[model samples]
Structure formats: C-alpha cells, structure tokens
Target: MLVDIRVQEEGFSLDAELARLAGVGLDVGGIGLFMGLVRGDGGLAALVLEHYPGMTESMIARIVAQAGTRFGLLACTVIHRVGRLPVGAPIVLVLCAAAHRGAALEATEFVIDWLKTQAPFWKREEFPDGQGRWVAARESDEAAAARWGMDGPTES
Candidate 1:
C-alpha cells in the first residue's frame, strides 16, 4: 500500500495530487476524495489553524494506518493545511484508492471522520468585526466519528 501524508501552510493543487496517485499503478479501480473548505458564514474573515509539529503528524499517521489496515486500501493520501486561511480556501483533503469502490469509499470516510476528532489541531475563526474566537468541537462531528465504532477518536 502507498501512504502519503503531509501537513503544510501552502495551498495544494488537487490535480497534482491526483496525478501522483495515478502513478501508483493499475490495480487501483476506485478513488475516493474529500475536500474541506473554510466557510464564509457569520461574517467570517479567516480561519486560523494551529498544531503541534511532530505530534500532529504522528497522530494522523496512526489514523491513516488504521484506515489502511481496516479497509485494505491500495493507496491513500492525506493533506491538511495550517496557518491563517481566507474564507472558501481548502483546509483538508483525503484521497483513498482501492481495488473496489467500497473499500476506497469506506476508508476515505473513516480517515476523515477520525481526523476531525483525533487530529491535534486548534482552530480559531476571525470575524470582520475585529473579533476572533476559538472554534469548539460540535456534537454533530463527535457523533459522526462515533459511527465507525473504532478504538480511535469518538464521542465520549
């Protein structure tokens, strides 16, 4: 299995990333992708993301490993951006490839759900009124992560 993980401040090109995955060879029959973007609601100006350097990478690596093992993924890539990002900018991307659609789709969903709750990242939203507030974990997200029934991040 091919696993690629990166956390960076620069914006990524989805086309380039997908092309890299295609280089992995011909056994891959399905590719599942998800992209998360900053919302423009509530007069938002930008979204700031912070993370512990080594710890964040380690945690996400663990999550990706678990997904690969569980779903028998052929290839996977996870990219998450940090620093201040303007509204509508992409924040996270997860792409999984497998021999069949089921495994690829399931692994993609599992990794993303776990990443949302397990990844050690702090988020703050800046408003146009010169106000900023730390984003709180939503109950909905916790619930979504819980459906996987894995031993990683989930609602208490």
Candidate 2:
C-alpha cells in the first residue's frame, strides 16, 4: 500500500495516476478515486491554495493514517495544489484500495470530508470584477470536522 502526498505544480494526468496506484492484490474487489476541479462563481478569475506547510502535511498524514486505523484500507493517496492555480486545476485527489468495496468507499469519503476542514488549507478567489477574497470554509466542512472530534484549524 503506497500513499502519495504531492503538490500538483503543473499539468497532471488522472488516468496515469489511477494506473500507478494499483498494487498487488489479484483479488482487489474495489478501488475509489476522486478528482476536484476548479470552479467559477461570481466572476471569479482564478484561485490560490495556501497552507501552513509542515502543519498541512501533518494533518493530512494524520487523516490518512486514521482512515487506515478505522477501516484497515490497503492504500491511499492525497494530492493537493498550492500557489497560483487556475480555476480548473485539480486541487486534491484521494485514491483508496481495499479488499472489499465498502472499506474503500468509506475511506475515500472520510479522506475528502476530513481534508475539507482539518487540512489547514485556504483558498483565495480572484474575482474578474477586480476584487479578491478568501472563500469562507463551508459549514459542511465544519460539520464533517466535528465527526473527528478535533479542534479545527485557526483561520488566517
């Protein structure tokens, strides 16, 4: 089981990554993969993902590790983008492998939900209307983070 945590700096290929994530386990019953793309809202031009370097990685590692503890998943990968990224760039990815479909699916969901709030990442939207602002963390994210029973990150 291999877990990759990378910063998507340039163009990335999802298919290629999915291919690489495959591992030994001829009886692999299920694999789950998720890709998040940029969005445009209210004339938003582009977006930037900023995080507290060491803390961000530690949080992610903890989340992935917790998924392992909870579900005994085979493997998982989480890749997040940083710096100036266009609206359509892949911000994050999570791939989970398991002996059965259920664990894989649950772990995938858990990783994404945990990432939204616990990861310490912030997004700034550059509006085409000559304005820029940070997207407030979603209430859903707060709700999801509560499931883990951990104090959320401090807003910047």
Candidate 3:
C-alpha cells in the first residue's frame, strides 16, 4: 500500500492528487476524497493553524496507518495546511483508494473523522476588526469522532 502524508503551508491541486492515486495502478477499484474549507462564519476573515512540526506528522501517519489496515486501503494521502488562510480557502484534503467503493469511502470518512479531532493542530479565527481568538472544539465534532469509539486524540 502507498501512504502519502504531508503537512505544509501551501495549497494543493485536487486534479494532481487524484492522478497520483490513480497512479497506484490497475488494482485500485475506487477512490474517496474529502476537502475541507475555511468557513466565513461570524464575520471571520481568516483562520490561522499551527502544529508541532515532526510530532504532528507522526500522529497523522499513525492515523493513516490505522485507517489503511482497517479498510484495506491500497493508497492514501493526507494534506493539511497551516498558517493564515482566508475564508473559503482549502484547509485539508484526504484521499483513500481501495479495492471497492465501500472501503474507499469508509476509509476516507474514517481518516477525516479522526483527523478533525485527533490531529495535533491549533487554530485561531481572525475577524475583520483586527481581532483573533482561539477556536474551541465543538461537541458535535467530538460526537462525530466518538462514533469510532475513541475517547481522546492519543487513542487514535
């Protein structure tokens, strides 16, 4: 299986990412992808993300590995961008390839669900009035991740 994971400050091209998944060869029967965008909520102008470099990547890799094993994925890629990003900008992308559509789709969803809650990243919302505040974790997100039976970020 091919597992590609990246954490960067630059944006990515979906077409190129899809092509890379396709390049995993003829045995891959399906591909699932998810793209997350920064929302323009409550007059928010931008979002700033931060991470602990090597530690962040390691945790994400573990998440991907677990997803791959659970779903029997053929290939997977996760890209999460950090730094200041304007509203409507892409924040994260996840791609999973498997022998069947069900597995691919499930794996994609699983990876993202875990990523949302488990990834060691911090975010702040910046308003147009030149103010910013740290974003808080929502109960809804915790509930979504809870469906997988994980209690905390470390368990993933």
Q: Which ten residues in a row have the lowest lDDT in candidate 3?
A: 147-156
lDDT, candidate 1, equals 0.90
Q: Which stretches of candidate 3 lie over 4 Å from their true place?
A: 150-156
Please identify model 1 stretches exceeding 4 Å from their true place: 153-156
Pairs in clash, predicted candidate 3: none
Tell me which of candidates 1 and 2 scores higher on lDDT: 1
Q: In lDDT terms, which candidate is top?
A: 3
- Model 2, span 62-127: residue lDDT tens: 788888777777778888888877777777888888888898898888888888877878999987
How does each model score on lDDT? 0.90, 0.77, 0.91
How does each model score on TM-score? 0.95, 0.87, 0.95
Q: Which candidate do you rate higher for lDDT, 2 or 3?
A: 3
Task: Please give the TM-score that candidate 3 achieves against the real structure.
Answer: 0.95
lDDT (C-alpha) at residue 5 in model 2:
76
